[model samples]
Each structure stands twice: as C-alpha cells, then as structure tokens.
Target: MRQKAIPALETLMSAARTIGNPYLERAKKAGRKIVGVLYDEVPEEIISAAGAVPVLLRGTGSDGTELADPYFRELTCGYTRHTFNEILNGKWDFLDGAVIYNSCDHMRRIYDNWVRRPVSPVYSFIYAPKKGGELARRFYAEQIRDFLHRTEERFCVTLNEERLGAAIRLHNEKRRLQRELYAMQKGRRIALTGTELLLVMMAGKSLPVEDYNALLRKLIASLKSCAETFEPGVRLLYMGAHADEPLFFETLESEGGQIVVDSTGFGEQSCELDVREDADPFEALVSYYFEETPAVPRKFGTAPARAGHLLRLVKDYAVDGVIVTRLTMCDLWAFEQYMLRPVLEKQGIPSLELETDYILQNRGQLATRIQAFVESIRSSRGS
Candidate 1:
C-alpha cells in the first residue's frame, strides 16, 4: 500500500506547485480570479471555494532593513514594513482582490493605510479578535461570515455551510498526512530534511488540500520502504520564528544534524484537532485556536508554556541541541529568544541562535557559522 501511494503523492505536490505567484501567472494568462490573502488569515480553501486562487502575500524576499525605513519607522516590525512597501511598489498589482486581517497592531495599521491610500486592485479588512473570550469568538465568526458574504457579492459566487464544511474536511486530511510525515521524523525513520519539509508546508498555503494530502501519503510510504538508507545524525529540535528558506536546515544537515522536531507552525500549524460537522462550525474554529500549539498573541504566560513545550520535545526526541532562528526585526520571536534561551541552556543543553532574512543570499556566511557550532558540539562530545 505504501509503495502504491508514491505516484499519487508526487502528483499532489505537482498540483500545489501551481499555486502562489507561480499559479497567478497562469491565472492571469487564462483570466481567472486571483485573490491575495494576508499572512495566516483567509484559509486557502476559502479562496479555492470562491473560484479564485489565494496567494499568501508574505512580503518581499529581500534583506537589508534600510529599504523599508522610509515608509515605516524604525520601531515597526520588519515583516510589516516590507509587506507594506511591496504593496506601494506595485509588486502585487496583479491581484484582483486582497483580504487583510488585523492579526497584530502593525498589521491593523497597514490595513488602514492600504484602505486610505489607493493601492491593490481590490481590498477588504477582515477583523480578527485579539483575546480568547466569548465576545472575541462571536466577533470573529461574524467577521468571517461577513467577509464571505462580501467576497461572494463581489465575485458573483454563492458560499454555503456545506461548501465550507467540504473545504474544512479537505484541509483536515492534508494536515493529517503532514502530521504523519512529521511523526516519521520523530523516529528518525525518514531522515526528513528541514528544507524539504518547509517546501511541503508552504505548498499547503496554495495547493488543493486533497491533492496535497495524497502526495504526502505517497512520500511517507516511499520513505518508509527505504528506511534502511536513512543515516543516524545528531537529533535537533528547532525553535524559531518562520524560517526564511530551507537552506538553513540543509546547512545543519551538512554538519551532521537532523532536525527531529520543530516547535514552529511549519511543523505544527495544521495540527489543530479535527472539527465536527455536527457542531456549530464557528465553535470549531474557536476550539482550533485553543487546541493548537504555540497559541498566537504571545502573552506572558504563553512564553513560559512555550518553553516548557520545547523542553518536552528535547526529552522526547533526544535532541542534541536547540536552534532558534529569528527573522532580523521580528520582536515577538526576539523576545521569545531572550526569554527561552536561559531556560533551555540552564538544563545543560547546547543551543545556537541565528538571525536571518527570507532570502538565502547570505548562505556563505551562515554556512560558516553553522559549521563552527556543530563542530564545537562534536569536539565537546569527543572530550
């Protein structure tokens, strides 16, 4: 059965590759509706259901914060400023419509500015609640429903509960297969590289869920049958803000480290437990927020809880060291690094922190630093 699944999985990945700006190119050529979704909101399924392609706008793949300084103040997070500048520069002019969510204060302000300033083909603000409370849930559900209503009106499409449920099921299956793949990493049976996994995860943002799941199942089966080829390496647990590229992990692998577990959304974002169709769908969304690991809106209690979560991964996977990667100007993860470093280090665990951007242009410098760190661990063990 495992061997049989491989062909299907490859096909699925092929389909996912058609999404994002790459897919937009084809959509434009063919004259299909292209909707750009802001980070982490507007599920890919929703856009698919609307007869439009959803491209996640993660901002420019550039370094050097100076490029964004003129538009946003120095205090603003780099991610926000870069995304805003991308819009100002017409980098995403091809988009037919955009869904922006108030995920953070910075994002909220960006949305406001986009509305006042004339940019993007079409735009809407999808309000997101900041707290976990009954009021917040009600507000968010209403907002999602309103957003759907507006999208339907604008695009001349109908969105019903049945369609939403189907989308939910499809996404759920994709996530299940991804979880299974991560589980294989936990046992070191697959020796899955981080770059490979990141590609798979990003593919999820735009691919048809059913097709993506099919590919993952096939990939997992292929790896299982070829388990004998897998080589043992230093088990690693990764803790970081979103990784810019998979090259960081590739470099680590070159230094004899295999990432056995990761605490970021790349590994666990889709792991939110399944939702029941019988229950109110809105309730399921709220439940998802609570059940998912590394709950967002990082408050005081959540930081220590996240650290404890990392500690468990260390023990469970026999991790040799923890690699915490922070995007240059991401304050949340920066604060997380400051807070969690001592906790992990005090346990007598070795750790390395790397600052990086979305592009791999600086791979030469990064490779040297990674090699040095890994070699130091090897020397310590030898002594």
Candidate 2:
C-alpha cells in the first residue's frame, strides 16, 4: 500500500489541479448528479444523502480574470473572479446543481452572477448565520432542514434519516482517515509534504467519499513503516483562506519552509468536526458547524478562542513559524489575521502575512519572502 501511495497522490493532485475533478467524472459516469458547493460551512452530507455527489467548485490558478471582469467589479476578491473565469470558460459544466452559502461579499456576488448565468441546472443560496449561540444554532438547524428539503424537492428524491446517517458515517470515516494522516505528520512518523497533504484533503471534496477513504487507508498503512524523524525544513503552520491548488504551498516550500498544518477551508479546517449519529443528524450537523468548526468569519469577537486553536496546532505540530495568507480582496481573512496576529506574537510565534491572488503571478517576490521567513526561523533557533 505504501508503495502505491505515489501514484495515488499524483492522481489526487491531478484531480485537484484540474478544473473539474476526475472523481466527479467517475461519479457522473456512474449516473450520479454532481452538486457544486462554494466554500466551507455548507454541509455536503445533505447532497450525498440526496443521492448526488457534492463537488466543491474550487478556482483555477488561471493567469487572468478577463472573463469575470464584466460580471464582477474591480474590488471583488481574486478567488471569486478566478472561479467565475473558469465558469465562463466552461470548466464547471459538469455540475447538475449548485449550493452557495454566504461567507462574504465576494461569495455573495459569485452567487448572484452564477444564478443569472446558470451554470448548473439548479442553483440556490443558503443563508449562514455569522455568530454562534443557541439562537444561532436553532436558526442554522432550520436552515439545514430547509436546504435538505429544497434539495430533495429539487431532485425529486427522499432524503430519509437512514441515508443521511449513512452519508454522515462515510464522511466521518474520511475525516478520521485525514486526522490520522495529519497525526502522522504531527508526530514526525511520516514524511508527507504540506502540498501533498493538502492535495489529498482537497481530493476528499472532489473525489467520491469511498474512493478517498480507500486511498487514505492505503496511504496510512504505507506510512507505518516510515521512520519518525523531523523532516528537514522550517516547520510552519499556514493560516489562510481557500488555498485549494498547490501553487501557494509549492512556492512557499520552494525554499526551505515546510508547512505541517493549515487553517484554510481546504486544509485541516475542513475536517475539524463530525456529525453525530446518536441524535437528530440535522441538529448535530448544525451544532458541529456552529460550535465546533473554527471559522474566523463565524466566530467574530472570539479571537482568544480562535487563537487558542491555532496555538494548539502550533504546539502539536511543533511549528517553528506561521504563514498568514489572504486572497487580495478577502476581507474576512484579512481582518482575521489582524485580530489573531497579536495573540500569536505575544506568544513569540513569528508570522508573515502575504496578500496574493490565486495565480502564481509574482513567484520571485513570494520566493524571496519565503526564503527570508525560513532564514529568520533558523536564525532565531540558533540564537
């Protein structure tokens, strides 16, 4: 199994690198509807329960945003523009339906344009509450039920609790496998590159759950024979927005900075919690999203709590430094970095913040920053 990991990783990375996912193609071939989701906090189990596959409509690291320029203003985040560009280029025509939830102004704009243009056969925007509490949870539960009901009605299928439970279980298994893989990296028992780990996790959103789990199981079994030694690099934690593609990590690690953990929606943050099976799945699912998931936009005024989670990862992964990245116009993560950086700095965690677009436009500049960051870490350790 270990020996087979190279090809499996490549396949997953390729799926993630491409515009439409390969597993999505497989699911389509199997006569399944593929519903495209935008970002985090949108529970995909609902889609899976409705007998459809949920594929996250991630952006391509395309060179230009000319296609989306007319639809969006200049101030729109590049991530959204890049995705819209891909949509206009006929990249996501494989989707049967789309679920868009509110996370920021950029995503809302994406929803607006997407609905008017109609890439998928059906498109709906689900309201997501920005705060957490009993009132919020109750409201979110209602929203989840409404979304589920809408999906069922739109597709003319019954999403009974049994099917939902099965989907939840399958998703949980995938999360468990991911957690195990991260643990191996954390313990220095396996040498999984940050870019590779991220690709595998991103594949989970694109690949069928069962296929991802099988590949993960094989990868984990393969890592068992590996030696537990700290990999040669400046161990780092990446806190950012949607870094689905490998370019960001590749450039950052092109020098000597090795990311062991990340807080992006496409990274460790995606699998932070699991839906409960004992109680009402809807209630549990809402609770997990509202209470357990550490989304910065949703947990405003809770910097200490959020910082504590980052600190925990810092300690767990033995991270030497932190890289805080944000899409050029992503206000949520920009403000998040502002709020969290002070907390981390007080604890002596060296961090560098970079604002970039989806594409690797300024590799020379980013590589220089990464080289400096890595050297700073080494200098501080020597001191």
Candidate 3:
C-alpha cells in the first residue's frame, strides 16, 4: 500500500503555514461558512454537522501587536496578543462566526476585545468545566446543546441525528489517521522532523476534515517516499502550552533533538481520544472531552492523571528525556511545570524547562539550555 516519492507534504505544509489556503478559499467561494475555534476541546464535530468549517485559529501572520497593545494589559501572554494583532489587521475576517471558550484568563480577553470590533464573526461562547463529575458532565452537555441550537439558528442549518452521526464518523477518522501519523515516529527513524510534524498537525486542522484525512492517508502510506528529510537525534517528549510557530520545534531539531513525541498543544493532546460512534453523539462528545481524554493542568484535580500520562508516553515511545516549555506569563502551564517537575525527577527522566514568548526572541538563550540538556541525556544513557 506504499507509494514511491509522493509529492504532497510540501503542498500540505504550505497550506498549513498560512491562514487561508486554496481549499479554504474554495470553501468560502462556495458559500460554505468558516467558524473559528480557539480551543481544541470546542467540539468541532458539531460545527461540521452545522455545515461550517471549524478553523482552529492562530496568529502566525501577525507582524506586531501595536494594533493590540493599546486594548490589553501587559500580562496577557504573547500568544493572544499576536492573535489580537491579526484580528485588527483583518486576517480572520473570513470567518462567518467564531466559537470562543474559557481556556484561561489570557483567552477570556479575546471575547471581550473581539466583541467591540465593528468587523467580527457572530459569536458563541463555550463553558467547558474545569472539573470532572456527573454534574459537570450534565452541565457541559446542556451547554453543547445550547451551542448546537445557536449554531443552527445563527447559521441557518438543521443538525439532525444522521448528520451528527456522519460528522462524528468523519472527525473520528481524522483522529485515527492523525494518531497513525504520530505512530510513524515510534521507531528509530522518523518520517519527518518535529517541525514538519508540527506543520502537518497544524495543516490537518486548517482544512476541511475530508481533505485533511486524504492528505494524512497519503503521507502515512508514502512516508518513506516523501520529499522532506530530517536527522533523528535523542528522542524527547516536548510538553506544554500553545505554540503555533514551527520555529520552536525547528530549534529543537537544530539542537540535535527530534521531538519524536510531544504532549504540547497541537500535539498528542489533540488526538489521544476519539468520540464513540455508537453512543448518542452529544453524550459521546461530552464524554470524550470531559472524561475520556486525560485532564490537562487547567482541569481540576488532574495533576496525578497528567503525570501518569507523561510517564506512560515516555515508556511507550522510548523518550530519552522531557522538555516542558510554557509562555512567559501563562499561569496555568507555569504551575503545571512546577507541579510535574517532581514527578519527572522521581522517575529519573532528564528534563528541561523553558519560559518563552510567542515571538521566540530568545532562541539563542533557549538553544544553549537545550544543547546542555541533550548532552546530559546522551551522557546519562551512554548513547
């Protein structure tokens, strides 16, 4: 089932690196609406069932936050700052609507500032619970149902059970293919560098489900023949926070480390679980995000579960070490690192923690630390 020298990775990554690709343009041109989503937990299957493209938005195209600086406080992390910059510049003007979630304090600023803008998408807010329990599950399901009704009424589409089932199956397939793509790296040689994989992951979310699934099928089947190249180094599990730019992963590759696996945003966290095909679609969606997937640090009482998840990944993937990176001002992930450090150490996993901004202006400094960490891992393992 493998093909020779398939030539689609570059095309897919090119589309991923930018905001709107030809596929996105084509979708818009066809009168299909694009709905922007800020969090991966935002139940995109519902968006698709409502006949819209659920774009996981990022600020890669932002040049500066001059447009954003005046409206926000200094403590808002660089991630949201650049996104606000892009918003003011009209990069995301293509969205017909947007679904915002209460991801953190920094992200809450998005809904507030975005509402005041004259030009913005019709909005729907999601309140994903920070805890796991039956009461929390009931509340989230009700919220999703409310979201569904708002989407249908706002977007003028009917979401029947059949449509919901179809959407769930399509997204579940995308999940399976994405996980399969990640599994391609479990061996000694990796098909692509961590940077390329980040772009691939980014690309997967940028396009429609069908198109992305096709690209993944081709890439997985023909990885040996893909045109891209990379050198594998110590296998490290890159962890924590939302970073859209490939510069972070590119730097890791340059420092003699291939992020063979990661727990970072747009990494393993997005694809580790799939919704049930047999259950009520809404209940399945609630269960998948609220219960099945490992709770992140932001979720209440999840530290032990998160630590166990990391430990299992290291053992499962043969990770040489772990690197925990977070934005300079992200309170949650800052605490996540502080809490998880002891767990990683108690297990004897060599690790590095870096505090960075969205701009990555301190690459030289971060790279120095990474070089030492890589050497330390090699020395300990006698590699």
Best by TM-score: 3
Per residue, candidate 1 scores C-alpha lDDT tens digits across 1-383 of: 12333454445344433334444466667766777676554455565667676665655344454544575666676567766666766666777887888666665666666667654455567776656666766777777777777788877888667676776677678767777776766664544555555556666655434445666777777777664334335667776765534455677566666677777664555453555557655455445543343555243356666677778778876777888887776777777778877997799888988887655567788778777777777777883
Off by over 4 Å in 1: 1-32, 41-45, 60-69, 84-91, 117-122, 225-229, 290-293, 297-300, 360-364, 379-383
Give lDDT tens digits, candidate 2, residues 108-170.
887888787733454567788887677877888888888888899878999887888888898
Q: Model 3 — which ten-residue stretch has the worst lDDT?
A: 1-10
Off by over 4 Å in 2: 1-5, 118-120, 226-230
Residue 178 in model 2: shift from native, Å? 0.2
The better candidate by lDDT, 2 or 3, is: 3
Q: Best candidate, lDDT-wise?
A: 3
Ranking by TM-score: 3, 2, 1
lDDT of 3 by residue, 1-383 (tens): 12334557776788777888998999899988899888656889999998889887778867689999998899888889998888888898889999888888788788888987887685788888888889998998888888999999878889988889999999889889889878877877777667777788888779988888888888786785565544466888888787877677778767788888888656677888889998988888888877887677778888888899999899988898898989878988899989989998999988899899887788888788889999898888788
Task: Tell me the TM-score of model 1.
Answer: 0.81
Backbone Cα, N, C clashes tallied per candidate: 1, 0, 0
Error of 1 at 342 (Å): 3.1
| Model 3 ranges with Cα > 4 A deviation | 1-6, 224-231
Superposition error at 137 for model 3 (Å): 1.4
RMSD of each: 4.3, 2.3, 2.5
lDDT (0 to 1) per candidate:
0.64, 0.79, 0.83
